[model samples]
Target chain A: MGISVLRVENLIKRYESGFALDIPHLEFQSGRIYGLVGPNGAGKTTLLNLLNLLEEPTEGEMFFEERRFTDLDPLDIRRKMTMVMENPFLFHTTVFKNITAGLKCRSVDKKMWPAMSKEALRTVGLKGFENRYAPALSRGETQRVAIARALVLKPEVLFLDEPFTNIRQRDIDLFEKLTKTINQEYQTTIIFTTHDLPQAHRLSDEVISLVDGRIIEGSIENLFEGTVEEIDGTQSVKISPKISVSVITEKRGKVNISIAPREIILSHGAIISSARNSFKGIIRKIQMEGQTVIVNISVDEEVEFTALITETSFKNMGLPIDSEIYLTFKSTSVTIF
Target chain B: MDYILEGLGNALKMIVSLDSEMAEIVFVSVKISTISIILATLAGVPLGFYVAIRDFWGKRAAITILNTLMALPTVVIGLLIYSFISRRGPLGVLGLLYTPWAMIIGQTILAFPIVAALSLSATQGIDKRVEKTALTLGANNLQTALFILMEGKFALFSAIIAGFGRVFAEVGVSMMLGGNIRGFTRNITTAIAFETGKGEFALGIALGMILLTVAFSINILFHYFQKKRM
Candidate 1:
């Protein structure tokens, strides 16, 4: 909606083990909390590392504030951003020092250090811990202090790399509240990665799905949840009167389904396939990613999903926006949660 | 049997008497060893941190060389420095041949690889995410390396103490480089060697006792750091 704060094009990171992070294109808007949801080895941390400037991409271009990321001084760029890793590591000093180390590095005013750090500690629910020895802190306390350490800087973008595991539900609620407050009051753009789908759905203003190295664009809008219906023991969920998606699960009263955009096949007419799921929808939007195309479709008035196809396939089909199309998916490809 | 008893009695008297000769030699030993370990700590900790954090070509080979140098024989180091500072040797013109500075230089070389190799091991055992945390928290490359050095501070101190222990008890470097100059350059180990060679076991046994105490104290420090790391 506004000028993008961070953007990547054709990002690729390759390991000697043959694993890679191959992002064709992605963008992050200013002043909005975004969540990266994916499974392990799905390249969430890789993306975070690249965005944080901790690692250079094997092949790609990154733009920050409309300038090439590599063209700017990386240290200056990194100082403006902050990241909290999954494992909390504090400087070998008092909690006060841990919270103020970045401020000291940035040459913040000395008179403001104590009060700012104390308020930061309070915000992360770590009040009265200013003098505590960092190494002696419990794991949860350490994580909270880490959050305080990052938040005290009041960075432009705060990147959290899967740091919320093992947190209690109450702490999770507090974290959610803290993120919302930071987003609303401070206008800090929060980008966090998580394996918890519901938390992502709850915490993020928008969510990006990364599966196998590629960004699943429009994944947040495409996640559909509905009451389960079993017709002759075929498990399905009815999102609307016109749409029911087949699922691979047996036990279901209510369930959530996620279909990768690439898994859904688009056709201009009824397509013959052994696949169990098919629905009629109109193309709502279309955008190109690299050489491929992403098509957003709405089967019901309220339910929208996306499909990935080639530009060649799109041109051969010659379907314009709002054109009716049949989409099909195999039940095995439908993930239930 | 009588000589052994007499030596023991004389050593006790010498230690209680605070003999100036013994004190001066002790002072020289500590001075050179202290300077050497300080230099080693300054140079080695950063090198170790770099060895721990950065990945470059031939890093494994570099680490292997350091690990090998950890067990390097003090006699070999003595001989190497001896050749360099000897007349007709490359560094002979400086004329530091039989002085305390020569011993200091030799001991510094001896202590450096120990501090570096141990610090490297210590850095490797630290939390791997600490570097990333430092970088993300606004530390530049040099500051991040210093932060990693800080994280392994205990080990680095222990490395310094261990280096002190090695050079303090060392005989070869001081003997070859200091020429065992009694009032000027003779340290605990070389003095003991000279006194023992002359059948004057009293001062030799006394210095041996001091050496044991220093080594035992260093061991205790090493163990304390080991426990802290765990």
Candidate 2:
């Protein structure tokens, strides 16, 4: 969207065993919330570490604002960024001291520390916790204090590695607003990793899943094989016996296309749309994951597609396993990869 | 049994009266052991932190060597220092033998390995995210090291307290190095040993009681801080 603030070219990190992380080319735009989603051991933490400058890439180059990361001063780059790890470890001091740790390191005026710390605390719902010892805090409170600690620095880029693991949604909503402020007010770029698929879709404009060191390119992929048909003025893919979906590709013959489950719109019945891809089906199964519902639809006896939706939407729809529904998606949302 | 009862009664009376000679012995012991532990802390804390964060070859062996040194006997260290600082020994012109400074140096060596070794263990036991979080929060190498040291402060202090316990109760180093001179180099442990040998069980039992109390107090304080940390 804007000029790239951070970019990695041919990044590869090798641990003692396993493929840690491998990214051919990646760019992070300024002031954008990007979510990295993957399962455990999917190199999400490795990429987050590389982006946070916590570890050196075993191979390849990283650039910040078009300058090579190795060429720039590491301290300077790190001073402009911060990371919040899963199960945040707070210092064995008062909450106020923990929050202002980075500021003290930068030699910020001691007088300004209290105000900054209070503001960060207020932003993270920790207004009355200044005098509390860090180790005495609950897990959720410790996490909020950690976020407050990072926010006190007003870092340019924030990296979070599984920060919301086992976190409650109430705090998550407040955290969402706080992150929005960081992006809107300070123009901070944020990169966070999560195994929660719906969270990635809800929080980020762009989401990438790294599975075994390969980026999944989109969220909740539902791959479909279809025969390309060119008619009047557009091309369409016939995916199943009853589903003929309009697509924007020029390729002909048998081909494959992948569409993100989040990109699909579900309705109780057929809905009118101009983009031209829709299928009437029955709900095959309902699977509830963290904060999300996966609705499996059987368009035909031989073909089924997964649809990603929020729990609220699924509840509001009052849909059951055998409920009839219609699925619609834009041709543009279909990715060939 | 009557003599033991008399010794106990006389020792309590001496303690309650705040006897000056007994006070000097305790004071000398505290001063020397405190200085020794302080010196060990200054050197060993940084060494422990450095060893914890680095990944150089032979790190495991080096840590093993430090842990082995934690078991070093007080007399072994005293014998080594005595051989070097004795009148016929090399560089004996300084007259450090038979002085409190020699006692401090010997105790410091005895405590240094324990402090460093326990510090290493404490640091290794911390959650691994601590250092990474510090680095990501803009801490430079030294600052990051300090951050971790602060995080592990409770355990680190416990290590120091344990070292102090050792120095406070040890007799071999103080007796060998300080020559047990009255009013100048005599400490609680050496005075207790000397009085016991002279059939003066009253002072001996009294000083031994103080040593046990001090060691128990140190352990209590360490456990207090450790529990608070947890």
Candidate 3:
């Protein structure tokens, strides 16, 4: 494990609209990609803004490299990190000007700006785009330029909010590779937010799941990466050699699918149901989260699935740890990304 | 109709011949208005930018006050400045009254509010993201403010041009403050007012034509920048 680069304790952000983010503790290590995954309005962007020092937390403290945010000059601390907004606003100028804006602010030598901007643009596969007028560029090109603008600063920590939301599938793959290259080559700590669970799992060394402004353990508990295939005239994803679950996707390729834990119906025995996928498994663990019970099940001793059921249902079924159980869910419950 | 045609013909002849007195009047008008507009721009742009970006008490009221001042009467500004520069007033020792300096001062006052108020609107119309983007990229508050001003450059340019237009064609300030001294403090508007009062319509008509041309050109430039901004 690397040294902790950023740490937050008892952070709280309150808005006049009655939305508040209260996080107890979190830490980010140096030179590793961390994915913050959550649905819309889950405070992902808000957290990114706080961590990047774009806004101060209402309570508690944040530290960068063991220095409290309040103790460090905001300009100095912000210079060490940069954030590329989800919908980046590029300056109305040439791409070169936009990319070197930070360098100018930092009072960097004017002679090195050209080389640095070119290299950053090349990193984003936008070679020779320095002279392009920002307002004339396409949306994808603008996003790349924004990334290059941040990359040229060589920040110690880079924050990206929904970096791939506006990108096409092919470019998304390219950008994902570019992101990995940046991390591996430069060793810059990267923290990004996305609601796409699979992308988070595929890219980050750690995935932090947030729901309704709080981090939860089982939000991504049922995520599975598999190859989508049509078998026996039905579309399904083959998770393991012995497990193929039906899905409702026309896509044929490697994909990631997630089933909401609450969507799975826990049964004592397999009964006739409209659900397309049913598996018999042994419950490996049972846990409680407020009024809901989380049941971790291992099927055929190969794949694991987590299901959420109310405490009342768990008691009615009289389920216990290490007990055989039946789990069933409809194909539509699977979200492919 | 014949009287008007005769005046137009003589006015064209005088303009084409570049009458020295007429040329001097035009020069004075351009010089004083240009200097005044420049001073107003220097003072107003930053003032407008600061007000647009910072939140303070009575900001809305401040903006309302600025908007009201945009329509400030030229004569009222002349009267207010006249009192200050008059021999009995505080600034009388400078001897600025009845001179080009006096006119410049009045015009600067007349144009300042227009420039500041329009610039406020220009900066306010800028996307809020510009500030955040610059700050996230390591810009200090001053640099971020500069970046936002750059982003709204076109509209700000139009603001300055609007200020120039307001001061360039105003007659009340120049007539009252400059005392319409021919071959010295006289400008286009004052020249037109003086020549017409003397029943010498040719020079007045020529200066009127020049004034219309300048106003038309300013409008063209303003519209060009406004379009580019959009």
Task: Find the candidate with the highest TM-score and give its number.
Answer: 2
RMSD of 1: 11.6
**Cα misplacement distance, residue A88 of candidate 3 (Å):** 1.0
Docking class of 2: medium
Please rank every candidate by DockQ, starting with the best.
Answer: 3, 2, 1
Question: After best superposition, candidate 2 residue B100: deviation in angstroms?
Answer: 1.9
Candidate 1 docking: what grade?
medium
Clashing residue pairs, backbone N/CA/C < 3 A, model 3: none
CA shift at B82, candidate 2, in angstroms? Answer: 1.6
Q: What pairs collide in candidate 2?
A: none
Top lDDT prediction, candidate number: 3
lDDT of 1 at A273: 86
Q: Please, what is the TM-score per model?
A: 0.79, 0.82, 0.81
Model 2, position A48, has a per-residue lDDT of: 81
Candidates in order, interface RMSD in Å: 1.0, 0.9, 0.6
Better of 1 and 3 by DockQ: 3
Tell me how candidate 3 scores on lDDT: 0.91
- Per-model TM-score (chain A alone): 0.67, 0.72, 0.69
lDDT of 2 by residue, A1-337 (tens): 7788899999999999867688999999988999888777879988888888888899999999999998999999989889998878888789998898899889999999999999988888789899999888988899889988998899878888887777787877767677777788778899999887777877887898776786766543566668998889888888877777778886889866777888999998788887478878889989887788999898866678889899999899999888789999998988653
Query: Model 3, stretches more than 4 Å misplaced?
Result: A220-337
